[model samples]
Target: MSNEHFSLQAEIAELENILRTIPEEKAISRLSFESRLEEARSRLAELGEPVVKEKLQLTFRGQPVDGTSGILADFGGKAVEVFSSAVSTVMASINGDIGERGPVAKKDADKLMITGTAVGSFGFELEVAGNSNPLFEEDDVTAGGVVEIIQDLLETAATGTDDEITEVVDVIHPRALKKVSEFLGFLESQKASCGISFKGKSFKFSNNSQLSNAALKLKDQNVKERPVEFEGKFVGFLPHSRMFEFSIRETGEIIKGKIGSKKIDIEQLSDNFLKAPVGVTLNSVSVGEGKPKYTLTSASDIRAKAGGGSQPPLTQE
Candidate 1:
C-alpha cells in the first residue's frame, strides 16, 4: 500500500479505538461521536479511490455551463452524494439552504443520478438534477456538471449579466431568493468598498492596511487601471520622503513607491543594503497619463540578493 493509504488506515484505527474507549458518562453527544466516525470513514474511502482531477464541463440546453471547475479529490465513487454535497456547500455559503433534495439514484457502481425541483429565496423554483459516471475508469461523468449547475446559479446571482440574473431568479425558489439577493448585495458592497474601478470590476486589496488605504485614495478618481501583484527588487530608498523605488522582475517596470504617512518606517526595511527582492501588491495602475503610475499597497517577503547597484532616479513623464 502507498504511504498515504497506510497513514489513513492508521488514523482510522486510532479514531476507532478512541470511539470505543469513550466513557458512557462522557459520551453525552452521540451526534458528535457519529460525526467524527463518519469523517474518518470518508477519509478511509478516499485512500484507494481514483480521484477526478480534470475540470468538469456541463452543458445545459446546448450551451456550455460556467461555474467553478477543478479537481474534487476522492468522491467515494458516488455521483449523487458528491453532487448533493457540492451544491449544498455552495448554497450554504450564501445562506441559502437546500431542503429535501434527494433520493440519489445509483445506477450500478458506475452511475448515480438525481432529479428534483429546488426552492430558493423569493419563491424561485429550479429543476435540480443531473447524472454522472462515478467510476473513474469511465470516460463519461456528469458529476461535475451537476455540481456546476448549482454553482452557475450562484455565480449568476453573484455577478452575472442582467439577462443571466433574471433567468436565475426565474428558476430560484422563492424561499432561497432572499438569501441569494442578500449574497449578491454583499458581493456588490465588497466591490464598492475597494474604491479602485476598471471595466466595471473593482480592485481587491492586499492584507496590508496602510498600503490598501493609500491605494484606495490614489485610485478613487474616474481613471482606468489594472490591479496586479508581483515580486520586485527594492533598488532605491528616499529617506527624506520615505519613498522607495522598485523594479518589477517580470515586467521591468520601475515603480516609484510611497509608504502611507503612518507607515513611514517601511522604507527602512532591513540593514542589508544589497538588492532586496520583495513582493509588491499594486492596488491599481493608470496608464492614460504619461508613464503608468503604479499604486502600490504593500511590500513583503523581502529577501537580499548577493550583489547591489545604484538604480537611476525615477522620472515623471
Candidate 2:
C-alpha cells in the first residue's frame, strides 16, 4: 500500500496560488490581493474536507511503514498553542520541545502534535469521518506512558542495581523481561479488537469480552499462558484504521506453544494486522521451528484515489 504522507503547508500554499487565479469577478481592475485571498479560501476548503476514503495498514517497528495514506487535520488552535507552550516549559524535556515538524516530505505532510522525538500513537487520521481533529492529548498520554516506562527501564539498566532492574520491569513491562522490550500493544487496552479462531471461521469482539463457547473453543487442558508479544513496533491495527499507541499489554496470545515454550521459532512468522479503515498489514518475524505465521487476510474499503488532476493549493473560507 502507498502512504499518503504529504507536505501540508506547502500543499496549502500551492492550493492558494491556484485559487487566487480563479477570476471571481468578470472584469476586476487588479484584484491581486483578492485573488490571493480566494486561492487560500479554496485550498482551505479542500484541506478542511474529510477524507472520502482511507486505507490503513500496520507495519512492524524497524520495518518501513506499509501505507503512508491518511487524512490531515489542523492543530492550529489557541488551546493547542497555549498548552503546547506550557507543555514545553513544564515538561522541560527534549521530547516536549515541539514547535512544528516542518517539511517532513516534499509532498506536503501534515504538522500534527507529537513529542519532538517520538512517533506518538497517531498517524494523521484522514478526515474519513469528515474533518475531525486527531485525539491529541488523550492518545499522547498513552504514548507518553509507554515512553516513560521504557525510558525508566533504559535508565535502570544504565546505572541501577539488579533489584532495580527487576522492579522497573515489573512496573513497566512485566511480560517482556529482557533489558529492552521492542513494542507494546498500541493503546493501553484497545479501542477496537477482534479475535478470530479456527482460521477465521469465527470471531470475538473485545468490547463484549465474550466469545461463542461453541466457536472453536481453546482446549483449556492444552492451553497455557506462557507469554505473548508483538514484533518490534508491530502492533495490530484494524483494516484502514489509525495506528494506536497502546494495546492490551496485560494479555496477548502465545499461539502454537505449550506451557514451557514461549518463543516463535519461524524464520518468517507473519501475523495479520488490522488498522480498521480498510487495508491489510504484512509483517515478518524470526524464522525457526514452531514460529507462527501471520497474514493480513482482509482490507478496508475506504480510500481516495491519488493523482486526481490536482491543481495548485487553494484554501476555503
Candidate 3:
C-alpha cells in the first residue's frame, strides 16, 4: 500500500482511540477528535478503502487483577511487554523474517492503541494504529492476521489438546512461537488467566499450571544443532534478507540459509565470494523433519589454496 494510505489509516485509528477513551465530560476534546475521525474516514473512502470497525480486547483475571477497577502496576507492565513482544514477533514473521538471521525492524509498523478498558475484568481494548485498511491480505501479515493468530494461540493454550497444540504450532513461525512460550511463562508465574475477545468471540485459559505444561510441550524435542566445517562454492547472498546460497563441494547440491554474523563484511561477500570456492564453519540446526539450516560462522577463501593455503579468515563469529 502507498505511504499516504498507511499514514491516513494510522491517523484514523488514533482519532478513534481518542474519541473512545476521552471522557464525555471533556466534550470539547471529544468533538475535535470526532471531527478528525470523520475527515479521515472520508479520505479513506475516497481512496476506495473502507474504515475498519473491529477492535480486539484483552482481559486479565486472578491474582494480578482486582475486578474491573485496577491491577498491580508491575504485573500490568509485564503483561504489556509479553503481549507487545508476541504481536511484534508474529508481525515480523508475517513480514518475512522467517530465517534465524535476526528479527525484522518493526519501527515502521503500526502500533497497537489502548482505545479503552474492558468491564467485569481488568483489561484493555486494542486496535492497530494503521490497521483499519490493512496492507496485507487476510491470514497473512496484516494487523488483522496477526490478531487472529494471537487469538488462536491463546485459545489453543487454554483448551487445545496436546495434538491440537502441536498441529497449531506446526504452521507458526518458530520465533513467534518463542514469544508464545514467553507469554505462557508470564501467565504461569502470576497464576493469572487471560482472555482475548475479537469479532464477538472470546477465549480464555484459567488453569495457569496446565498452561505451563503446554509451554513445555510447545518446545520441539526433535530439533537439534551442531557445529561443522565444510567446503562449498558461495553461490549468492542477499544482504537485505540475510539469506545466502552455497553449493556443497562434496555433493554438488545447493543449499540456502540465513547469514547472521556481523563481523563479516557483507559487501565483501557480495563482491568476492560469488561462485567462489570457500571453506566455511557453520552451525547446522535441524528440525528432524526438514533440511538442516546453516548459519555461517566463519569463512576462508579456498581459492587461495592455489598459492599455498587458505587466506586469512574472512569472518569470525
Better structure of 1 and 3 per TM-score:
3
Model 3 global lDDT (CA atoms, 0 to 1): 0.68
lDDT of 1 by residue, 103-174 (tens): 323323223232221121111112332332234223323434434544455444334444454443333333
Overall lDDT per candidate, in order of appearance: 0.39, 0.27, 0.68
Clashing residue pairs in candidate 3 (N, C-alpha, C atoms within 3 angstroms): none
**Cα-based lDDT at residue 294, candidate 3:** 70
Error of 1 at 297 (Å): 3.0
Q: Residue 36 deviation, candidate 1, in Å?
A: 85
The order by descending lDDT is: 3, 1, 2
TM-score of 1: 0.24
Candidate 3's displacement at residue 209, Å, is 2.7
- Candidate 2 segments exceeding 4 Å error: 1-139, 142-148, 170-173, 176-317
Give per-residue CA lDDT, model 3, range 1-317, as digits (tens). Answer: 55778999999988877777889899987887888889988997788754454577888888889888998889887887788788877777656555665754574343567778876689888876345454544434566567777788667655666545544554455677778778877877898878888877787766666666666655556434567766767788887876788888899888876665455666667666576666767766653344566776544423432322334435535
Each model's TM-score? Answer: 0.24, 0.21, 0.53
